[model samples]
Target: MYSNLDRPPLNVTELRRGLDPFFSQLDVVAETGSTNADLLARAADAEADRSVLVAEFQTSGRGRHQRTWVSPAQAQVALSVLVRLPGIAPADLGWLPLLTGVAVADAVRSVAKVPAELKWPNDVLVEGRKLCGILAEVGTTGKNPTVVVGIGLNVSLTEDELPVPEATSLVLAGAEVSDRTTLVRSLLRDFASRFTAWESAGWATSELADVYRERCATIGAQVRAELPGGDRIEGTATDVDANGRLIIDGRAVSAGDVTHLRPLE
Candidate 1:
């Protein structure tokens, strides 16, 4: 049996002391149903901008398309961040999740020392195995709508504990997993920096697209994208467009479930 003791609790106090000034609010709970949901509810408040929520265990964590994400207690980094993006246009908002993917991949590569690449539309992969999933939801709470970005990163889950066979963890990828505090800090800081820069540039995509392209593994690969309405498209992915849509076979896909047909060589 895998004891929960092996995965210790996060140091909320230390995290707050380190991360408070950047975010309007930073909270860490022992457990929650979903950090994204909680943060979305909080977005109704006036001071919800830059609010960050983290959970040690999620009872009802969800991913894109309502897919449930389950993991052992204290085995993953389940977190959500809310940012008021009144300045950014709705069309440009698609970049938020992709930006998050780049930040997460960078964090994993720097902290875990693993080569983390990104699957289009925001799945972090290590050696072709999914290590994290990102979900960004829009909340029309105040005069300016808010965007809550949720990230779930596997830190120490064993093979049997994975939600899917294609999923992996830092430990399984031969990375250290004891100090989740550091990983959390790195992820938050990196995201904040990139998001701030992107917003400062009036939601421009030049720099963000460049960074996303460099870290994205789906580009330059054969892909099968299952679009909405039960339609699918198969082609070679060439680029991520200026608006953050996956460009597959000359088609700019705004939304779809992309699957790589072959491994990254």
Candidate 2:
């Protein structure tokens, strides 16, 4: 499936070689409707644990709250992973996305040699502009639940190509944009290591809460949360709870569109 990619196939080959020690299997696709969509389909047909799907371009990429994620070929890293955690209740699945955000933030800081912070819910920011995004979808079979974690990172996009004015790429943020292969490998390695630790501890929320708080940019700032019920709550971003919900002014918000508000100088 990866043979016909617009970029050289050796990039993925190199990535696979680097990640050989960490992951059991990796699947690279040249083009797809969406990496998350493909992995979910594959997971439903055959339960493959720790499987990865990466695409150079996504024809129908998705974002949080059903937003569209569009990126040009060789400009971004679009990937998804299929994870199976046993004995984990459905109610506790919110941590998956938060955990993934922490992973991505760590990877970007380590690889790009620049600081990156996470916005509540699952957005990575550099210089207060979005550099990456994560979407986690949990689906349950008869007995097992599958979590497909999808990540999209802007690597080397021009200002005109950015979907939103608030978005920025690694290069734009004054960080060196490495090859796609290196970026993907580094991200997978960090995620796999963190996820292993998280699962082994039975999805301990306290362990991740500290790391998330340290790397979060929204905490202690005034922000606006666009709630699902068509109401907006503007408050100080306080903390993230054990369930990974963002605490705004002492209120636990599980789901909402968070917009960081300008602070008064």
Best by TM-score: 1
By summed lDDT, which 10 consecutive residues of candidate 2 come out lowest?
1-10
Give per-residue CA lDDT, model 1, range 45-154, as digits (tens): 86778988999889999999999998898899999999988767777888999999999999888988989999998999998999999999987644477989999999
C-alpha lDDT of all candidate models, in order: 0.90, 0.83
Q: Model 1 scores what on Cα lDDT?
A: 0.90
- Which RMSD does model 1 reach against the true structure? 2.2
Collision pairs in model 1:
none
How many collisions between residues are there in candidate 1? 0
Clashing residue pairs in candidate 2, if any? Answer: none
Cα error, residue 239 of model 1, in Å, equals 0.5
lDDT of 2 at 184: 84
lDDT of 2 by residue, 117-211 (tens): 99998899988899998998875544468889999998877899898999998877877645678778888888988888888888776887888
